[model samples]
Every structure is written in structure tokens, then in C-alpha cells.
Target: MARADGPRTANGPRTGGGPRADGPGTGDEGPVGGSGRRFAPWLPGVLIVGGVAFDLSTPPPYTAAPFLAAAPLIAAPLHPLRLTALAGALAVAAACLLAEFHGVRDWAQSATEIATVVTVALLALLINRIVRRGSKRLASARGIAEAAQRAVLPVPPARLAGLDVAARYVAAERDAAIGGDLYAVQDTPHGVRMVIGDVRGKGLGSVEVVAIVIGAFREAAEQEATLEGLTLRLERALQRERARRADIEQAEGFITAVLAEIPRGDSQLRMINRGHPAPLLLDGEGAVRQADPEVPALPLGMGDLGAWPDRVEELPFAEGVTLLLFTDGVSEARDAQGTFYDPAVRLRGRRFAGPVELLDALVADVERHTGGGTADDMALLALRRAPVAPGVDRGR
Candidate 1:
């Protein structure tokens, strides 16, 4: 709730299935890294030799059975099925050879050691099969999750209503590909309009609300004549959704959002803030302005508490000035000592050639500040007014 000087802070409609799925990306590195593959062939050999040496050095009653048993186990996840089988065979053969060298080949203990190696070898092979199967299943699940993410949050076109647009959604969880953050940009009859919002909670519930908000925004952005009108439509949509849910969910669910409209043949932009973060306006000369709302209003779905008329704040939308919109993930990112990240301070004088570079820099700066320890999901959208051609009109 702390306000900063003009530079206060730094910095999708999808519809779909009953429940959403999520996953991280670590599984993609399965068995293919330089270090892993480089040592793969020699690791089994080293283990076998080490097991032999341990067995030879130990007293007659003691054994290196554990080391001998581990050779195939280590190979199961890192090597091919045939290589795993070979590792198991080598371990069994080594145990047998040691038994013979010690003159215990005919002893019951030797047979038991040999049998133990064989049983472990077979189990290692089974483990190899299970790991491979799991990897395949994981790959399949990742693919489906990515597909769902694309369907729900389609990438905005590079150009929208004559403005350059770039958006990014970074999930806080490493394995998670998507979260509750959402954005949508459309070239509507009224001009170009965009909405960015953050759902209150996480998981399926948040995703469901995101779909509802985006679906409603898309429908209203094209038809509503004013930014305030579109916001009212979004509020009604959230209210209807709340009505469909139980009392607990109705009491808890809410969405913070910012809606903007840039009318054609005009040099100014209009915005409606519904308890969302103020967007930063960056000029071509590297100046920044925080477009905070003049009248505060509750986030979407809290109309029951109190209702205030949405105020449309208008600001100059000069050519080459980029407008940045984001969720609390960016504003609330804390450093190790708990100091909040100030995008206004970090990016005050720094300039980027375009929206993409600006967002890339901002994200990198946040990571550096938090030492890569962000707690909430972040969604960023950067829109810049394209430079007019020598003969083109500035507003048309």
C-alpha cells in the first residue's frame, strides 16, 4: 500500500475443460545432458571395479554386497534398457568371479550372494522399465498441459490496433507452466482495448475464474463503447460466476483488473482501474508516469461490499510511449531483506528499443533482486504506440 513517486512500481482468456492440469519442465532433460551422457558409459565400469576392490580388501566374513548391488541400480535411470541389463549381468558375473577366487564357489554363502545379485539385477531391470514408462507419461502430460495453456492463453498478435504488443506470463512454481494470471488484447470496433487481471487464488478455481473474466472481457471489449462500460460488464460476469458457486467461494473469490481503451484518431488513452495496480507510462525520452486511479473501487466480484462508479482516467498516448501493465507479482516481489522491488526506481531512466526488451529487462531485474525467489505468478503486457510514417497522420 506504500506509494512511490510517479515511479511507484516496476513492471488471457481461455476457456476450457472441467479442471486444469499443470506441470514443471525438469523432466525434459531426461538422459541427454553433456555431463550425464559423458559419464554414462564409464560409471557402470567404475562401480563394478570399485565393488571388486572393496570385496577384495574386506575381511573374509564381510562383503561389498551393497556396492555390488548398486551398480545396476544406478544404471537403471541413466542408461538404455540394454545397457541396464548389461550392468546387471556384469554385477552378477563379478560376484560369481569373486566367490570363485575366494574358493567359496561351492559354499551356500556363495550361492546366496550369486542369487542376491541375480535378484537385484532383475529388480534393476524392472526399475528401468518403470522409470522409462514414467518419463514417457511425464512427457505426454507436459505436452497436453502446454496445449491447454496455448488454448486458454493464446499469444497476442505482434501488432494490435496499430500498436506493438508483447506479453509474458511467468509462473512462480518451477514445474508449473501456467497459473491464474491472465491478459487479453483485441482490436475492436471502438479502437484497441486490453485487459489484464489476476485471479484471487490458485489451481482450478483460479483458472475457472480467469476463463470467465477473459471470456467476458473479449465479448465486451468489442461491443462496449466506454472503458467504464466494459468494466461494469466484467463485474457483472464475475458476480454471475459468484452466484453459481457455494457461499464460501462466493465470499472468497475476487479479481484485480485494469482495463484500457485507445480510441482511433485520438492522442489520448482511457483506463478503468478495479482495485488493480496502476500501469506505468514510459515516454520516448525515458520518462515514466504512474497512471493510478483517481477513485478507488473494489476488485471485481466485491460489489456486494460497496459499489463506486468507475472513473475513466485519460492520459496522453504519444507515439513511442510504452504502457506497461502487470499484476502484484511484480509490485510485491521482495528481496532477501524484504524490501519490495520498485520498478519505477529500477527503470526510471533506463530505455529499451521496444516493449519486448523492456519486459525482458524488467523480468531479469526482478530475478536479480529476489535472487530468483519470486512467490507469486507474474503476467506482463507492454504496449507501445508505433511511430507514424513521414506522411501518415499521428492519430489516424
Candidate 2:
């Protein structure tokens, strides 16, 4: 997988329309966005033996010996190639010395061997140049990818006022930092509303849809007082974008979303589910409950079918309650035997000191269940409300 940073070229300094230093805006988009690079590893011994054999077999009065000396270039860049060239020269010199062991060394023979050695040495130098240049390019590419990722998805804060907020994003495609998974939490006039959604597919198409959905959610969630309205707002926005694309209807793709509004000074938490996996509520007393919607909720982008938003479910998410919202990457994560991960079963009765601990434990549990490497990208978002004062909202 090639990284989205430094791009690959056929050979030489491959040129393309790049960001001009004095151009209009910052060109954060790399040649390859998100997808990592792939490289073929070189074998050392094979090239060395082949080079020696070629030198031995070829009837060369000229310096094909130098080319053979340079054989190790196939294995590495500058450092090893330079060493190999020097080693080849020394070997040739020693071989000549041994041939005339009984007598003084011949000038003609020494000159030919030395010349062959020097030729190979120059070839080694060429290999060194290639390696040094490659490393620099790779480093530059890495820097670009890092900058772009930060711009695309900034790191979430450790805490949000009284709420313990933790969020993470994983790339489905190898080396990709930003994907279709998106989340936004803002303190609005109504309340501290939040959204977690997974757009359809991956790559540029999904990213575009994710941006659209997030933009709509952020705008509507702040303005709309109710979760139902926010759901409708996101759906309508997705619908409008889909209508613009000609081939959008031909495909069956939608956004699975979970929207929540935490009212100030209220133990009850209001949420609207749009066909997404129900969020997990981890209580202070070591209890876990799946907050599934009462009725079958349709995913966003299907408003044309006349699906109704379920009434906002207000669960008792009192102080010290942690809400875990995730994408299918976590719920649908598969084990070695091809079994879907059951968070409810695994996290049952588990005790955690804080929201961070709960998230870390859950992530580790998922990794252990799947043996470390995950096929799908998982996004984990945990929010824990602090324990209120004694008798706070108790009679209310």
C-alpha cells in the first residue's frame, strides 16, 4: 500500500503538475491520497552470485567485470553498493597477488584487475545515489501525509467540560488516515449535541459524502432543538447531494447515523438512531445496556421512501454514565473463525475507572479477539458524564 504522501514514479525524477510554492492555497492533497505505497524488496545473495557468474562466464577483455562488481546494487542503495565495489576491487587485487604468488606480480595483470575493480566501484556509487535519493523522497512523502491527515481529521480533545470525551479514527485501507467515518460534538444553544456516522463505501466518493453529512449535521444539530429534526436535516442534505449525481440512485448506499443531545442538568439522554448499531450505555455501577431504538429506523439518504424518525429515546444516563458510539468496524469486527464481535457480551459487567479506560479496554479486547490486525477500520467514541453533586436532580 503506497502512502498518500510521497508519490511513485516510473523512473528518474517524474514530473507532474505539483503545488507551486507561490500558488493560491496550501496544496495538502498529495499525489496519492490515503492509499499507501507498495515496493518490491531486493534479494542480496542472488544478485551477488549472478553478478560474479556473469563476470566469470563472459569473454571480456573490456570491463564487464565492473558491471559484475556492481551486481550488489540490485540488493541495496549507496552504502552497500560502495562497500561491495571496494570489496570487489580488493578481491580482484588479492586474486592477482595469489596467481603470481611464486613470483613478482605482473604490471599488465595488476592494471587490468585494478581497472575492473574501479569500474565496479563507480557502478556501486551510482547505486548509492539511487538509495540516498529514494530515502529523501520517502521522508518528504511521509511529512506530506502527516500534514494532510492532521488537516483532514484533527485530534479530538481529551475532555469536553464535564464530559469525558474520547474519539479515534482507523483507516480501512492500509496507511490511510482519513476515511468515511465522521463525528462531531459541539456545545450549542440547545445542548451539547453529538453525531457519529459511517458513510457508504470508501475512498474519495465516501469522503465527499462524509463531508456533506458532517457539514449538514453540524449546522442542523445546533439549530434544531430536537433529534428528529437533525435526523431529517442530515437525510435531506444527503438526498440533495445524491440527486446531483446521475449514478447515485443506481447504487444502494446510505449513511448509518446516531445522533444524541445531552441536555444541561438532566440525567435523561435523548438520541435518534438512523439504522445504526445502538450505542452502548456503561453505567457507573458496572452495567451495560444496548440503547437500540424501539422501531426499525431507516438509514439516512433514504428519505424518499417515507421512513419516519423514531421518537427520541431518553435513557437514564445519569452522572458517571459512559455512552459508547461506534461504526460497523467495531460491531461487525470479525475474529479468526469469521465471527462478528459481540461488544455487549464481551463488555458485560466490566469495571472501568474512567471513559479512557473503558475505550482502551474495549479496543484492546477487540484487537485480542481479532488477533491484532483488523480488516475494517473502527471508530470508537466514548463520553462519560461526571457524577453530579449529592441529590442533584434527584427529585426532579
Candidate 3:
């Protein structure tokens, strides 16, 4: 039961995929390599031994396939060139022994052939070298993805001018990028605005939609005079994009989004629900009320078929009140017995110091519920009106 911190140990041999999922990311493979690390080392040994066994039994016609056998062995870069070189030598040795044992050629000819095989063995080390560099570059790309994701979806700073903001995004698949769910929070001259939505598909295509939607929200949230106007703008933007690129809405591609704008000096939250799951507003004391608008607008992109009539819903968000906006992943997540996750009931009245704490707790709870990974991406954005007092300086 010895559990080591994952994704923390400096460029060393990766241990097994210990116990926890959210634990530190191990290996030099960035978060992409976080899912499994426990059995990585033993793989090379098993393959090398198996290759040697095969060589002994068959010999000629069967060249020891080092790459085939030990491909996963030298997967991480930290392993020395020696391991690969050794693997290659083993293959060549098998070739030479088989040449002699099977009497395929004369002794002198066999010796010369084995020398060529040995040279090829060393050359195989170069392949390992190239793979190692490639892994490093891939890890670097993953880091850039993390930074972009943060900037695009800022973790609500501990405090905003008039709101408390906290958020988290979890990819449905392990080691995946942002995928299908997206959330954004920003404070504009008009007020504190937020958007949370789920795109139709997964992978890079869904991420592209997320980028387009957020880009539209950031631009429209500021200029538009009203929340309804903002909704119209977003719907049109989506349709315009679809019209220009007919492939955008291919098969099944649409976005379910909920946009909220808190006027500069009001406790009311003007929300325009666009076929998304209703968000919940938690009272300072931990009571939950589903903030579903009466007139539900169509999911973005299908707006041309029908006008997106926006309805503003008002909720009494007192000082320290928190509004939790989430994609369907959280509510729809099921346990072993098929019980759905109840965020309101589970986190009722719990005091999360800041956004990081809130997200950490939420992810931990979700992992516990699903036992490890959720099938669909989960995105959450929680905004709490900072205790309207004059003591703490809230981060933007």
C-alpha cells in the first residue's frame, strides 16, 4: 500500500500507476502519461526474456525482433542508451547462434553476417534516441495546452470585484485535452458575466467549438446592453459560422449553453438558458434552488429554425452566496449501483475557501463517485458573491 506522489518525481524511472487518479502526474509525459505508470518498468524485462526464449527454440529464419519485443521498455526517455543497445545485441546474438545452429551458411560467412547484425543493433539505439526526443516534445505540447486552457477558462480568482468565482474542467477521457465541456468567467464594465456549455462531440473538434463559443461570449458580453441581446449575438455568431462552414453541424453537432449576467448593482442573476442543464444557486447557508428559466431557448446553432427568445431569471444571491454552473457530466455521472451524483446534496453548506479548493473537492468527489474516470468531460464554474465586507482583497 505504499503510495508515491504521481507526476512529481524528477525525470526518473516511472513507478506503477499507484492508487489515486488525481494524485500528482508522474513521468516526463506531462499529464498525458498520468493514467498509468505502475507497470511501465517490468514491460521491457518481460519482452527481452521472451525474445531470448524464442531465439533458443527456433534460431534461424527467426531474427530476434528487439523493437517488437521491447518497444514499451524504453518508452520513457530516462532509460539509458545501454538498454536499447543491449536489446539490439541480444537480437544479433540470436541471429548468429541461429545461423550456426541451423547451419544456414559457412562459419566465415556467418561471422561476417553477425558483425553486420551487430552494427544494425547499434543503429537501433538511434531509433530510441529519436523516440526519446519526440516524447519530450509531445510533453512540451501538453504543457502549452494546459496554459491555453487556463487562459481560455480562467480559474475564478479567489475574489472578483462583485462576485466569488471558482471553477474546474475535467476531461471525460484520461489524458485528454479540454474535449466537450467549456466554461468562462469575466468581469466587464457592465457586470460579472459567465458562460458554461457542452458541445456535441468530443476531441479536437469539440475544443474548436468551445474556442469559438467563448470567443463570441467575451466579445458580446461587454458590448451588448442586455443579457437577451447577448444571447441573440451568440446564436447568430454560431449560425454564421455554421453557414460558412457547412461541416460544423455535421451528423450531430450543437451546443447547449447557459449564459448569466449579474448587473453591476443587483443581487439578481439574469440567466438565458439554451437547452443546457439548469444551474443551481446555493444560499449562504447552503440551501439549493434550481435556476431554470421559464422560456428555454434552443441550443446554439439551431437558432435559425426558431428565434432564441431569452428570459431573465432573478435569484436572491446574498453575500457569500454561490451559483454553481455545470455541464451534464456532473449530474449525469452514475455510480456502480446507477445512483446519480447530487452536487447540491453532497456539497451543501460546505465552506470552500477559494476556487482551487472548490474545484479540488469537486474533482475528488467525482472521482470517488465514478470510481476513477467519467465517460464524458465535466466542466464546472461556481460564482459566489464575496462576503460584502471590507477586510479581504479578492483576486481578479
Q: Global CA lDDT of candidate 2, please?
A: 0.66
If scored against the real structure, what TM-score would every candidate get? Answer: 0.82, 0.69, 0.71
Residue 101: error of model 1 in Å? 4.3
Instruction: Arrange candidates, best lDDT first.
Output: 1, 3, 2
- Worst 10-residue lDDT window for candidate 1 reads 1-10
- By lDDT, who's the top model here? 1
Better of 1 and 3 by TM-score: 1
Clashing pairs in 2: 1-36, 1-37, 2-36, 2-37, 3-36, 3-37, 6-141, 78-128
lDDT of 1 by residue, 185-217 (tens): 888889989999898887877877887888898
lDDT of 2 by residue, 171-238 (tens): 66665767778777766777778888887776667767777777787789778877888888887888
Give lDDT for model 1. Answer: 0.79
- The alpha-carbon root-mean-square deviation between model 1 and the true structure, to one decimal in Å, is 15.4
| All candidates: CA RMSD (Å) | 15.4, 13.5, 10.9
Q: Candidate 2, which segments miss by more than 4 Å at Cα?
A: 1-149, 245-253, 388-396
Q: Taking the candidates one at a time, how many backbone clashes does each contain?
A: 5, 8, 8
Q: Identify the candidate with maximal TM-score.
A: 1
Model 2 worst lDDT run, 10 consecutive residues:
1-10
